[model samples]
Target chain A: MTDPSSASLSSAETDDGAEAWVDPERVSLKNVLLPLLTFSVLLLIWEAAVWQARIPAWLLPAPTVIGEAFADWWRELLTHSLVTLYETLAGFALSIALGVPLAVAVVYSPVLQKTIYPILLALQSVPKVAIAPLLALWIGFGAMPKIIVVFLVCFFPIVVSTATGLTAVPPALMDLIRSLSASPYQTFVKARFPTAMPHIFVGLKIAITFAVIGAVIGEFVGSESGLGYLILVSSSQSRTPLAFAALVVLTLMSIVLYYAVEYIERLMVPWATKT
Target chain B: MLASSSLEVVTTAGSIDRPKAGARAVTKIQIFDLYKTYATRTGRTTALQKVDLDIRENEFIALVGPSGCGKSTLLKLITALIKPSRGKILLGGTLLDKPSREVGIVFQQPVLMPWRGVLDNVLLPAEILGLDMTEAKARARELLELVGLGGFEDRYPGELSGGMQQRAAICRGLVHNPSVLLMDEPFAALDAMTREDLGFELLRIWERHRKTVVFVTHNISEAILLSDRVVAMSPRPGRIEKVIDIVLPRPRTLDMQFSPEFKAHSDEIRALIRRT
Candidate 1:
């Protein structure tokens, strides 16, 4: 507990104010190149394995065949990707429109916290996949149903993370503000909300990833235009490469959406996220 | 509480910039027969009992005791963050029933928001207090410079060492120009050298700002070093055992801690605490 040598070492190691770790935001070429290199290597390996095995495209398409499907079906692929993107964005917007206010209401009112929070937990536990079919039956096969699924998937995490962030203020800071005789509004604006920003971003990132899966789930249950629908129709027709291409689009969509959230977090909560 | 021999040091020891000691100062705070009880799982438990003290304007007092001795509770009570079961506090001749604007607080932790830069962290109190931002920014910058965190204003708390963050916290506590600065073991989390350095830095800040400083600490020597009087408290229905008037020279330093009179006061406090 009282090691003088180690204490001196720790004192010596302190940078005063400089961070010791590698900056997360630092954009080194090696960082970009390493991931790109690995992905290319993996794709090349896949191409070699499929060619050596003489595997049918219907069984498992090689990367090149999938690329060909992309080239051939570019127009249809763009149309489906746009449909999916619209649903994802619409649902995500709806989630933010509702989820953030719901979080604030729940955090402020104990009655709402006790009542609404439990209901949310109960509803959330019933899988979104299970609920998608019911939603489709009730709402019919439209973008509305797909967007609703995305909304359901995205809303809970936003509410939870926002509520947690709103309440997660350090007790000491609470005391400091209290001692200042700060009004409740001042307390929230100055202390509570900023504290919650980082946590809200945490929930937002989680919900963004979930939003894509939700849209896909909705399409799988019953839809005609989204990437999920393309995958279903293509697979049924034994056009495995087309299905694989749809998957590649969905993967890219998820990555782009996640990075969008990450970028916004950097802008909005720079102090929390910046190295 | 002071030995007669050190009366000379007590009066003339302050920096020439600060006012001379030994003149009777106006009473800044009056605690009257205070008692606090908590509703425990087993039943009601008394946290503090029969506490009574007078804090003079611009006087630096330290509350020193072991853990669970209710020193922290007393600070909260003084801030009016919590209420006493019986009796009351008068802050600047006003009844202290709610969180008072007359006092600022420095908690054990720096508690700086990681989302805010050091300047903005110090500016929080001013913003919450609804002071003029233009003036507050000026005062905040001045405080940061005074605390030797001059140029690191834009850095986040994560970038600073524990000592630096605590220094920024001290600036935050003073930015609103509150008459009373209630510190609850503010440097306890810091290393020994940093803690000592901060204690002296605090004295420097206090000498200029002239707040009625109520500093709480478990460290006996720290209490004796920085304070004009050290309030020794005891546990199990915590109450003050003695108020040892340090009577040490103004603008206290770490070197004073090893002096014979400082050791005498330290040993006196240790013996009082051990008696419980």
Candidate 2:
């Protein structure tokens, strides 16, 4: 009785297993090698064009000049990078602290959802860059304004993603928990929160990238130190290579932070990755 | 010249005999005058009407019917997942108005938390009920082992096959050791072969644990195989049509399915459902 079905299922599973075995190796090889190769080729072309065209350093710095500038001011660049990173991390952390609870409240209470969701949407629609100068006037040219701008920029995605995650729990799973006579709090912790982790991480990833941009915007408007401030100072001084170096550092920081979030996501919800 | 003779005919041919072992069985769940009506945007629709049933302790009963017969609704009502609209459900002689820890349930889908491993999924009920963690963990392990998933404790639900996942779900339902276990077509999603395998697996588990089970299914042979009595219901204002006692001996094997007695019972139930 078991033979026919078991045989069919086993054959199907073996086929899947064989396909899965080959996929990861090919994907990893392509993911790492292709990006590196593309970046190297692009950099070589940029360097060759600068040499061939004999472009002035002030107009467009070559890759070699940018590298030289990065090496010369490595200490300064590191300090400014640290400042920006701090702002991004702090703002991201604060958003998670405040936004998740707000989302939970919105999800659980219809009255709150009705009253608060529209206001949040309206606030989010207003461009945060337009308010940075006003924030600088209020908080002065310090890290606080940058932090506030980062917080403002990143808060909406967290709230939206968390709320979506909480609401997206399967009805059957909810029924299972409810059937257990679980309290509302128990239901949220055990069923809703865990189920929402993947969605929440998605929001976090998007918000992290935006946070770096927000911090930079804050610095551009008014700040004495930071990668954005460095870029502003270098450009005003006509040190184009230094500005390029600062931009590279900022891009690298953003990439590193995004990947860190993704790494934590994989750790927190390994089951999500498999499917 | 005798006047025209009058005669009365009596036959016990189709009369349902309550399983002999049930003579001393205590009533565990008393469902009285149950009525359910759903108010949709269109209007009120009656889901179930004036249903009455008494379930004996440790008796495995199957509610068999066509789709839309409110069989799943009945399971929901028992678990207090939904209100009956008009009747009383008494568990152990006490009126049940809300979900109680004294009952456990399994749905058509396994519904195992994808985030949880097999053992953790089984311990979910215990954790919710605030039971002893050490004891519950030990029981979870044992239950997993009982379902032939002993070494799979660390595997996530996604890692398991559909049948294995459902088995884990069943283990979760029984983890708390509730007096009654309710299943809503738990094996309906499986292929025929897996369905049969799970049916026998369920029987094995029931034999060992002996909890009062009210299983809902549309499969006639499945009902006959696993249940002590099969309650047939009609659709559109779902109501009980008839109850048939399965007098087959204990520890039933798959080979017994081909016997003449089994065929007779299957034919009888099929005919009854066909008429509905």
Off by over 4 Å in 2: A1-12, A15-27, B1-23, B271-276
Worst 10 residues of 1 chain B by lDDT: B1-10
- Residue pairs with backbone atoms closer than 3 Å in model 1 (clashes): none
Q: What is the C-alpha RMSD of each candidate to the true structure, in Å?
A: 5.1, 5.1
TM-score of candidate 1 against the unseen true structure:
0.90
lDDT of 1 by residue, B1-276 (tens): 222222323343443323455565677998877899999899998889888887778888899999988999999999998999999999999999998777888988999988889999999988887889999999999998888888889988877778888999999988988899999999999889888878888988987888999999999988888887788888897888877777677656667877899889988999988776
Task: List candidate 1 segments past 4 Å from native.
Answer: A1-42, B1-22
DockQ versus reference, model 1: 0.41
Model 1 RMSD in angstroms? 5.1
Write down the lDDT of every candidate, Cα atoms only.
Answer: 0.87, 0.86
- CAPRI class of candidate 2: acceptable
lDDT by residue (A187-208, candidate 1, tens digit) is 8888889899999999989999
lDDT, candidate 1, equals: 0.87
Highest DockQ against the true fold, candidate: 2
